[model samples]
Target: MVDSPDAFGRLWADDYPGDFLRDLAELGDRMSGRPGERRAAELVADAFRDAGAREVAVEPFEMNAWKRGSTEFGVTNPVERSFEALALPYSPSGDVHGDIVDVGHGTPEEIEAADVAGNVVVASTETPPGMDRLYHRMEKFGHAVAAGASAFVFANHKQGQLPPTGALRFDREAAVPAVGVSAETGTWLREYADRDGEVSLSVSADTVPGEGHNATGVFGPETDEEVVVLAHHDGHDIAEAALDNGCGVATVVAIARILGDIDLDTRVRVVTVGGEEVGLLGASALADTIESERMRSVVNVDGAGRYRTLRAFTHGTPAFEGVLDSVSDAASREVSVDDALHPFSDHWPFLKREVPAVQLHSVTPERGRGWGHTHADTWDKTDARNVREHGMLAALLVRELTRKSVPRPDADALAADLESRGLRPGMEAAEIWPAHWE
Candidate 1:
């Protein structure tokens, strides 16, 4: 708790933020498609209207909903053993009560060796090697799924409590419904198979193209202007996105409340993209069409509730460095300026289109860490005050950028910076020079 001049909370408390916290707490409840989120979005729209914005609408997008499918697993042998497990978030359904075949780790080699056709494949957890192996393993898994394995069940790893879980990312032509299971369950299944010779179970689920949406609404009017602020609204569909992004939307809405009441020289756009959990689809869509010419910069807020280590970075040009500093100058003392990878959020698409953007974030390790696409990220982990601070920082930053014109770097300098950052051409860093790096 450093007594710094740039504490964002003081600003968050400004403008008499009455009932804003209550509104944020309610946001969690309203977002569940359950009364929580449904109502939360409504409240946001209402607030937008009250803010005197010209327009406010909830534009819906399509996304598939993964529901529970028929699930049954047990060991059929001298000793009857029933193992516990559940289908992955987007797993396929297989009611095959056939014998369970040990496919080793469900690896391609293991699958090829075993006769798993029409049979359930009890797979062991196979992490190729290093932390970087996840990518190759995932890609490999996609190929394995496409190879026509009847069903995929990930055996528990030596470590990791819950079934080693993951979602499949196949090319446009390939799709596989895979689920992970607990390591204990895997061991039991294996032991049962060794003792019983054959173990049969039922694993069926409602698997198909899911349909949901990336709901979005823009604030402020047209002036060939853009100050895109982002927060992902979608979660695993189990918990309220309170801190995961419920707070993010709340922060964005808070900014709307602050900046909306006053007239600004530049437009302040707020987008709570969907399918962020699944992928950066919503953000990508915006990035695809955003008039880079109009886009000044993007400010993304994620995991705002706990700046236990709030950090910011600039992956953009020199002007963006100024943008980052401008934002940081008003951020909390708890916030640090650290180097990070890509925004990896809805901002990627904008970057692809050459829009200046960066994701404001904080990272926390958990008992079962890396809950990004897991069921572990719940509402209980959210902190309201932290979320408020996140919103406050964004509002102040946007206000600064909208009016203050920073020094734009020349093309060569911008190019050199992008190159040093290992940027690829046509991606976001390709073209720069004499440009605002917009």
Candidate 2:
């Protein structure tokens, strides 16, 4: 038992004594469905068993494995120059030459108005303030694909030589060559788009069908209803992928260790899924096997614990706000809540089913995946103190969610909420909008 809120605080302080840090450092570069990801899953399973969780199981699922290869992006017209570029994961090998069409900020409206057919489309990774939701890399690429573009280029918003990298496709191969460039390179590309200069894109990669595992463990009571705490173990191959998910995986492990022995009214399942970066494949796989009605709620920790404070995406489940408020108030912890239905994380599979859920992440003043999906996503950007403290808040929330009951939302209501949130345009452009909504 946690005993009291003060005791929980002390536990959080004492828990991050440095052992978990060493563990995370050892699990370096956990790319989805690869050896690094497998090692991470094994480590999490061992930790769960060591924490006294019963029936700890590592279930395997099939995933399309994507191997990174060399990429070449150059402008042949208006002063020939080659810019440094990184190939997005799951991008197919191709050689393409077309006119560069710059879609400023890559909004749905911009994509719809541009004549990208048989041309190369260039979009920024930054999301404009006028949009209600964040524009994802794949969404931007999807817009290009929808416009019949021969290739896609994503430029970083950050002012550095660092090129952004993310999965171009999930569970399937990309239809066109997709690459990322730095902000400086993006400016150069814009010069070409302004004059309608010809750009050449060449990509080389390999793909094979592979498998990834989900580390699942059952804690607390034996009940029909289950509250699942999930975090993805997979990350991009560019860097250590620490802040993007390493902090999340470690925090979930610590939460399971602390709350496993406590008595509760419902069962709590700790899940560390794989193939998240390549599209929430592992989470969707697990959700398919489980009965949706049996799922009480989900607390998905993806980009959380990177900062001292934590925030949550409630996905329009107002019933979930009570749990967040109670836990934050009880622990005196800083946990911000956003009642938006963000369809970008591991919680999306469950949320699409109308199961109540929240995707946990660290709040930042800057927008558009700051330091999230790049080579800069290393371990040093995070601290053990944030991990432990965030875990404490998650533990408290899990306990409360297990004790209390929240209402389940219907699919039609969720679809309507998406329209109200101004998310339907992006979803339709990205081709991920639910078919039933039509």
Instruction: Give the 10-residue window scoring lowest on summed lDDT in candidate 1.
Output: 425-434
Q: State how far residue 398 of model 1 sits from its true place (Å).
A: 2.4
Question: Candidate 1 on 1-438: residue-level lDDT in tens?
Answer: 122243343545654233543454544423222334445555666656665555566554444444555566666665666666655555655554555667664556666787666555677655444322122224334435545655666665644455544434310111334556677788776765565445555656543454333444555556687687777665544334445666566666666666654445677777666555544655665666666777887877765545455556554544555655656664534445544434345665566455666667664553212433334444556565665666666666777777765443244544566445443231231111124444
The lDDT of each candidate is: 0.54, 0.83
lDDT of 2 by residue, 211-264 (tens): 888998988878999999999988878877787888898888778767755556
lDDT of 1: 0.54
**Number of the top-ranking candidate, with lDDT as the measure:** 2
Model 1 TM-score, 2 decimals: 0.67
TM-score against native, each model: 0.67, 0.95
Give the number of colliding residue pairs in candidate 1: 28
Please give the distance, in angstroms, between residue 38's alpha carbon in candidate 1 and its true position after superposition.
5.0
Best candidate according to TM-score: 2
